[model samples]
Target: MEKTKYSLGYRNSYVLQQYRCLLSIFTGFIILLFISNTAFALATNPGAVCSNGFSQGSLTNADYTNLVSAVNTNNYVNILGNAGGSIPLQVKMTTVESSTNTVKSNFGVITTAGTSAINIQRTFPNISAYTDIIFDFRNALTSQPIYLTNVALSAFDIDYANSNGNTFDDFVEITGVTQAGSTISGTLQPITGSNIVFGQPPQGLQGLFTRTASDPNCTAKNLGTQCQGSVQFSQPVASVKVRYTNTGYLNSATNQEIDLRVDNYCYVPQYIFTGTVFDDNGGITAAQANATNDDITSSGSIYTNKPNYFNGVFNSPQESGISGSTVKLVNCANTATTYATQIVNTGSPIGQYQFSVPIATFNNNTNICLIEEYSGTAYPIRTTSDNKNTGFTTTTYLYSNNDFGRVIAANAALVLKKAQYINNCPNTLNYTDPSLNTANNGDPKTGFSTGSISNMTPGQCIAYRITATNRANIGINNFVMKDILQKQGVNGATVTSVLTNPPLSTTDYTISENPAIGVNGEIKTKSLTLTSRSKRDFYFNTKYGTTVDTQ
Candidate 1:
């Protein structure tokens, strides 16, 4: 009994151990899955930092020294030479690495140079769209790699303004540096002060060195032993001024100077524009529809209502996006000169488009316009919000949501009706006037009816009452009606002259008379503007020539 109990206890213990091992494996799988999903999600959320690295290729220390002298003489110099016109570079220092060093090319070095602290300022184009600036840094003393203690690096946005003055009030500081190619592990400290020195003649800077230095693994023997690691700005900056200070090591007599070497500088540029195009078919209020211009401006809200069969402003979901449309970016003052063109997106989030221009392209342009070309079957345009200002003086960089709107055309129709009347006259020997038994006074108010008439005699007076009606829901402009007063038969009466009276005071219209090719009378109504479901009546009296008999 004791042996059986022992075997059962051992087997239970073994099963319990297996369960724990399985649980450990399952937990690790869950952790890996979570990590992978997070990475996948972040793939679409791109970092704002630009990927292009600024290399100080083949530049010697003498070259940088000469450049600094020139900058001091001229107050500023361009480090990029002539890439983006004339951006100012205040001062810089350079150190060439070994030819085989893959991690760094030529490094921008900042040293004490007989001072306990040093401030280095560098200027470039706008970097407002970026969130961080990353670069590699290392420590050395008189061109020899040596790990230094109590070192701190602080960055300031020189161009940024605060309530105190033009300089940024706060700055980001980095300490506790590690070797290069390794993850930067340090304590980030914030410093606050006034009148931060950033330009030439660096002096009187304020900051504390709290970072502990780690010995770097040296690889480049020709450039001396050095440890390196990267540092990233905690906040977005523009026209930066970096200050390096050390309190642990100070031996100017022995030429044991502490220098901070920096390379692989990067920041994002603001030169992209994005927007979407959609069809405008959602209904609007009667007041909005009747307004002179129904287009919604950029400052206006998105209109939302029932779908209108005729025309309306743009509404999302109710009116879908128009895919495959052509959008072009052109000069606002001169549309003939096109800068960029793209087709509206056809995939998910349809009708979206984007434009990415180079810094030089953006710098050269001032006022720009985004225009969507009309397609063969496209509806009429309803709204536009595509113009933008990209001047050098303007601070706005990244543009988005410059949308357009369009709607279907309105239905329209017109109808016309004509009638004639005869003059009152007694019957002659061989001819009888049609007005013998009828009350034909040649007065339009009493004699003219809304139908045709026959059995007319020569030298009789006739009148015509023509009516035109608009049968659409919209107004019609430039409505014209014409009539020739001679018939084709041999017995047909020929009109000699047409007399017209003033149109009714309720109606607005005009009349004109002219001779036909072979007839003596032709009457036409001047261009008339008609409202929706409106009608107008035109009247004229014609005197017939004595050339035919009664029929």
Candidate 2:
């Protein structure tokens, strides 16, 4: 029972607080884990990152051969070289001695090594796989200097073996040099060799080489002269075709062989995405934009007049209420025939406008326009009489349900109907027609335009309230409906008096004539229950511009 006191040290308290914080964090993390497990899962799509089939990198000579094999049956590669120029330019592992390999001094590899006997060397890392191969070279002798002539490229399965067994058969000889040189080098090295073994003479490995007898300095012979032996090493190739000159050379003074190398090649697919364009006109059926030789081509509709954006499709004002409108997706650039055509129906909903058009149709250079067919002669007419109406002269009148009030009621209904779209949905949306406003001279008119809302969400409670007042005069019976003649033209022209019926909803608020412009000149205030049905009808009217305006 003695007084016992316990003192907590500052250091101990700090440590204890840290431990408590850690424990609380650990508990919170565990709770978070449980919540996450219950939630939806999301991961990046694999195709979104890597969609190509082959890994991208430079291929070796052997690897290149494999690629050629892969694409052999398909003819995927496009070769660019002379008629006999495109042979495998890969290094041969076997060594060639001076005796086994023939070398002409004037035509052979004038190696910087400068040895009497040149041993052809085959470098390692031999193969360079490519879609195809190209070959380009220059002669060792010419009247002016060294230049290429009678250029041709040949493709074969073997890199070093020539049809004649002597690689010289693959030689594309040039005949316009005056040098007294001898010996031709026929070394086939992928990294660096000149000799290409093109088999067989009838196989047409050698393109014709010519020379003019007039030029004394041009002593180069057609077959041999300074013709360096061909170098034939091969990398794997998807294709082996020769791109050669069928015409003249320096001797002809009109053409000359090109100096080049099978520097690089590529193998790419034809098309990436496929889809179509839909006919979204007010009435007609839609068509698709499809792929044509790696490109998107579309055949569809044309805009004869201004376009109308109703719901999701592009419609025409002229064809808005017209039945059996025709539409198709066509390539605007092509003077070609249309692909598909469909009949469009009048008053069709937005979502039902187009069918079967793929998403890729939007990517093409297709133009979407509305071709409207004129339906009727009696079009909408405009008027100029301050279209608003007023009751007879009276000082203080009880306000009756008039055209203006009815218009306001209609608007209120629309507010309810479009509430969901304004609050939650982001994309453009449309609604059906609402019941006509019957109050006084008010006529229901439908319209389409962008809309927005505030203080509500889709599936939430909505209400409509209206208040009407006469600021100038009061104390008389101001009715809501009236049949008054209005001149819709200049001056007091022709007048058409029409009686307006009240709106459909009986649920409404009416404020009798009041003494107050209340606060801010507001004479009366009416509040009505805005039910879900009212909202739907109201939104419908808004789309068609039928909703009337009130006070």
Candidate 3:
């Protein structure tokens, strides 16, 4: 879409003179930004094509004599097109004078050997559609991106299926001679009836598969969205045109360069026989992918609320596509290896992957947990403990890499607001998170409030109101909430008594006091018991009197 610019004429000599210079610079800047953001390109535009529309090259004037001789010498016609047990081997052949689609190179090649075969090498200006397609692939796997180019602009008809009987398309149809050199343009008919092609519907197929935006049979195994391929032409000159394609994920390709060597060209297909030789069986594990380009940065005034997904990204180094994996969201404070889970599927562009949570699992401010969003083959994840270290509060999205790669993960601050309510210390020593709410009901939320473990004086029978929660989407098992007392440190707050297991993932703990409460007071791992499977709560009182008090 073209942006509209308004012209302002002050008609006041003073004001007009003052802002004219500034207006000129501002206009130029706006034009530059518009061009950069839009990245208008002709290669991806469907309207710039010629009369015949991008065509599929066909074989014209087929000389059966040479082909018959080659077939007799080979004798390998036992496989393809085996409809009625056998095909008439000696059938007469005719010439159809197939379209002479000539390619004119855009990346600067004047000619091709003696016969005109364009060797693909180097980068064409990127189609913004390619980047757009990349993002689409990311979000599609996680949910569902463009690269733009102008090579097909006024030169190669973006819509041309025919040329003065010489329209250009995707088929590498070579003519004007034998396989060795050029001569008179040969006329061989497109393979029909008994002739078989890999990607055709077979109903009315009299030729090769012509790539288009709507061709259902357009497919290239292992490429992006296999069946969505489309032919793209880059012809800046008249004599030679180069056509690769939109591999069919909306854009053609980024820089996945392909170089076809002359002597080593081994993928030439022969009619009458076809079979798979090497099938890709392995997956593009996250450890094998490049760093994913998806970021989870806080993007707008309000975060996305649709099935609020916590997207995780990872990279893969291999190219075989991806597989599904699992991530465990475990509570940071729980001593037990308790956690909930979310399934992360393999991404759309093959190697990239996206992980998401329904955004409805977090309950309260006490909901602080740590888990790796990346749940594929390990790139060696890098993350800190979930609120495990001393004085640590911020919930971190673990970003791990197998070999020093990076990925952006959507990390929300898991609110574990802890503050001592009782005025047991100096006024300046007390603190509470001002943003925490008074309560929570465990729906989908962003911020929450949770009271803390506070300071106490010697023999200051302090009542510890502990309400902890694991706010992430996953759940954990057998969480432990421990507290202890020592002689030298600030008097420890004893677990005064048992109350409701508020959060649930923190319940059913066997509250046993060390030495039976004051025979040298210490608590033996106030851990949850066997029955409590997914309790996410913590509640107990404490009498402060010892030098060393901790949880």
Best by lDDT: 1
| TM-score per candidate | 0.32, 0.21, 0.25
Q: Which candidate is the best by TM-score?
A: 1
RMSD of each: 24.1, 32.1, 28.0
lDDT of 1 by residue, 1-551 (tens): 99999999999999999999999999999999775444222011011123352211112344344443543242332244221311122223322222221222122333222211122322211211111122222211111122222222333222122232222212222322233423333322222221222221112223322222222212221122111122433332222323332221221111011123222123233355667777654544323442222222223532322223223234566656677578887877888788888988888778877786645564476777787875636555344434444333334445666666654443113456555666643222111234422333443334555444566676566656676765433456777677766643524634343332222122333423443222344566667787754667775555555343222
After aligning candidate 3 to the native by TM-score, how far in Å is the CA of 37 from where it should be? 66
- Return the lDDT, model 1, position 317: 65
> Model-by-model lDDT, in order?
0.40, 0.23, 0.26
Q: Lowest-scoring 10 consecutive residues by lDDT in candidate 1?
A: 123-132
Judging by lDDT, tell me the better candidate of 1 and 3. Answer: 1
Residue pairs clashing in model 1 are: 176-211, 179-228, 180-228, 180-229
Ranking according to lDDT, highest score first: 1, 3, 2
> Candidate 2 or 3, higher TM-score?
3
User: What TM-score, to 2 decimals, does candidate 1 have?
Assistant: 0.32
Candidate 3, residues 1-551, lDDT tens digits: the string is 12222223324555777699789999999999775334321112132233321111111112112222333142221211111211111211111211223122222111212211112322223221111000000111111101111112111111112324322232222111122322221122222221112242222222122345343221111111221112222321111112233223222222222111111000111111001111021122233322321121234312222121111212122213233333454445662453355443344443322222322233332343434343444332222221222121223222222111212222221222322333232213212233322444221121232333344345443323333332222232344444543344335534332111121122233434333333334333344432211123332333345443232
Total backbone collisions for each predicted model? 4, 105, 94
Off by over 4 Å in 1: 1-268, 283-313, 376-393, 409-551
